[model samples]
Target: MEWTQILTLAAKEFRDRMRNRWVLAVALVFTVFSLVIAYFGGAQQGAVGFRSIEFTIASLVSLVIYLIPLIALLLGFDAIVGERERGSLDLLLSLPITRLELLLGKYLGLAAALTLSTLAGFGLVALLLWQRIDTAGLYHYAGFMLSSVLLGLAFLSLAVLVSVVARDRTRASGLAIALWFFFVLVFDLLLLGVLVGTGGRFGGEAFAWLLLLSPADVFRLLNVFSLDDVRTLYGLASIVPTSLGSPGVMGGVMLAWIALPLVVARWRFK
Candidate 1:
């Protein structure tokens, strides 16, 4: 409830991550991967150069979907459990800080660290490609970066929830990895499997709505539908309905993904 308590805890958490060089490492990884994708993504096709912004973004979207969630899960999977494992949770709670303050502070601090690293990593690539991309391209790229941040925040929320619910750090981590695998890898395959097994008789509008259930898919749709070329490339034009494809609607869904987990964590933490 108190902003001062929350901010103080957040500052400590942020400083801890910075001192350990986690942010820099993540940023570097993003920068390297992004630069390579931007410049050399066409190497397999016998051409090697910076491609169009749409193609670059489309490639990066796949990268972010796979990478960001894993990073975020690892970052926050132990947030609360680690403190408890070290016997610091009780001591921290004994201070003036309330439970809500601690939870919010931890989430905010981790979210800040992830946001900075993602922006710095991808923003550098943006700067490098600035001359080649026009204003509209720049706009789309910025949207991609923002949506990537939301995706990270959403997964970090899930990590925090796992931390709150699990009995120990090991369990929390296992849950986090299971979550990453489910949302990033298995969720889509299962959906498609059902559609195929049912021979397309089972899914129409309902199928598209199911994609909204996973933050990764929502992020995918958000970025894909925003660009005509990329959307056509993904062949999602028929699968995703117009109403669900709106950026505002998908953004709201992403926000829910970020908030709902934290709400559950807060409840369980108490």
Candidate 2:
């Protein structure tokens, strides 16, 4: 692949998203919700102020898991199908770029936009709380932001694959929402139901491995296992064995989530 052509296409995609105000809207949403959760999240218990970084991160994880995946799916579900519907895909194909370069360029561009929005939104909160938080706390918060970006990219990869396989934008969107539901809402519940139904007898050792199947779960474990207080708050200390909880392991799994879908998308698009 020619780096010049790939970078040019990526820049075009990024500029298109910027022109559409997608980045600004997402950044504002992140900033507003993050500030609210940081300051008033513990209001019910009469503890309304800048809490510890671990506590803040724990609160944000729930929000990120639900919000990021949905946002990512929506952002990328139309990457290919929308172009096709607009009668632009064929026109673009008639150009000098190859399919692999086009697909990679699109994914990289979307990933950049998603990462920027995440950082801008969360980075503002980090700045506001910097004086109050210590070095370790800052590090933890940074990790959360990084992992959040990874989680978004993973889902966006899936969206690109859906766009490639679906015949139309409508079906692509339906598939995106279905994916969000399956990974974010249904996957863990199904696992718990199976374990409960079988009295914890079935899916023994393999069950722990199964969590890797859902990118959201991998993201959860990556952040939750990082800090002591946050881990206790999440209550997954026992369930997610020490062996599988390594940052290296979880990061690799998240990378796989990002890669497998993109590989399939490249194939399908071809």
Candidate 3:
């Protein structure tokens, strides 16, 4: 539809984000946290004679799993709802732009920022690692960074969808935070309990499905790039079991997850 309008609004949204001091602080915190984890974890692995590839994979996966969803939640949960609460959303809606443009522009802005941040962070880590050690893993690790960034955008869209429905920042933030906690922290624990209580009976099929439900696990699968390792680690699924699927299939699923929500959010626009 209005590509120019959408792009312009998206640019404005990106600029407006500069005024969001809290988000700036959070982004800084995320950067610091990733650096600390990477440095310390990489050092420990290097000392233990673990390969650089393994260290990078583990470090990046852990960082993205723990932090990305939180970042997405914080950034998106208040997207529309916050504006509505502040009386600015009404003014914006009163403008010439349609609701679809509003939603699309915000999503594009969030997605662009998320992508840029991950790419920049990965570049820094790659530079540091190159100075420290060389590994064939760099190539795969690059792919991991790219896929993880897309997955992070999926979570951002999920939060945006919540923001749209709730139409109030407080309620949407509460829901976003609660869901983040559930998926990040509690979901796996609950799954573990179920697996144990069932004497591991439900674990095989259930945990497989859990990957579909939990974005965190899907991200982990993306990191499992080596096919031999996928088989050794994932079993006889032919589709890279421990992973979400093979790289090709995994990419499709992750994109679907991201796109489906943005579509819904767009369609539901007033």
Candidate 4:
């Protein structure tokens, strides 16, 4: 738990990603996609240009949900396993660093890279739209960016856990993609299908609790509930309970998603 050693390892991880151009590639992806969505997302409605921050954020939420988790998984799914395959894991373990410090260092470094890219990508768009948005709109956009970072960190934690448990990088990657698919695509559909088939008998108040299981959903609720226009646009006004919609609640849930996986990964790595 020595801060100096942890920070040194974290700096090394960050530098490795930089040397590999991982940061540049991800930052470019974020910037391009965000700019496109901000300007052209409303084209179907015969609208084009920098629309309201609400609409931009709403569109960005969908993009972040799909993109961030995949990037995080790709970035971290092989963190441990790849090292092991390269014969570096044992060498690193032989150093003066404790396992907890090593794990935390790696996580911090990856999280920093993700956060920097996310902010750079989305922050550029926010700058472009700065003059177009009001104070409230700016606040909403900022909140969206923060939550997007949280979502990435959550998935990265999962990837770390996958890396810890998998026998090799191939299996780690497969598990990471499966994790993304389950949380992003399949989980909600299955929940809805169950609710429909059972006619609300199976999932009553518990339905909302179920949404917390998926970090993406928690991120969605955090953003969607913040803006009135976006809330109604998503048709979540009636379905989402007031208590569960609180920023405090959703933020806590997102933090839990980030922490729980890292805890498990720490245990497994040990």
TM-score to native of every candidate shown = 0.98, 0.98, 0.84, 0.98
Q: Candidate 1 vs candidate 2: which has greater TM-score?
A: 1
Candidate 3: list runs displaced more than 4 Å: 18-31, 42-51, 132-135, 225-244
- Per-residue lDDT of model 4, residues 189-265, tens digit only: 99999999999889866888899999999999999999888899998778889888899999999999999999999
lDDT winner, 3 or 4 = 4
Best by lDDT: 1
Candidate 4, which segments miss by more than 4 Å at Cα? none
lDDT of 2 by residue, 28-82 (tens): 9999999899998899889999878888998899999999999999999999999
Q: What is the lDDT of candidate 2?
A: 0.93
User: Would you give me the overall lDDT of model 1?
Assistant: 0.95
TM-score attained by model 4: 0.98
Write the residue-wise lDDT of candidate 1 on 1-270 in tens digits.
899989888999899999999999999999999999988888888989997999999999999999999999999999999999999999999998889999999999999999999999999999988999999999999999999999999999999999999989999999999999999999999999989999988875599999999999999999999999999989998878888889999999999999999999999999
List model 3 lDDT by residue over 54-145, tens digit each: 65466657678888888887878878888889989889989888898889899888777777666666666666567554565676767777
Candidates 1 and 2 compared: the better one by lDDT is 1
Pairs clashing within candidate 2: none
lDDT of each: 0.95, 0.93, 0.73, 0.91
Q: After the best TM-score superposition of candidate 4, give how far the Cα of residue 270 lies from its true spot, in angstroms.
A: 1.3
- Output the better candidate (2/3) by lDDT: 2
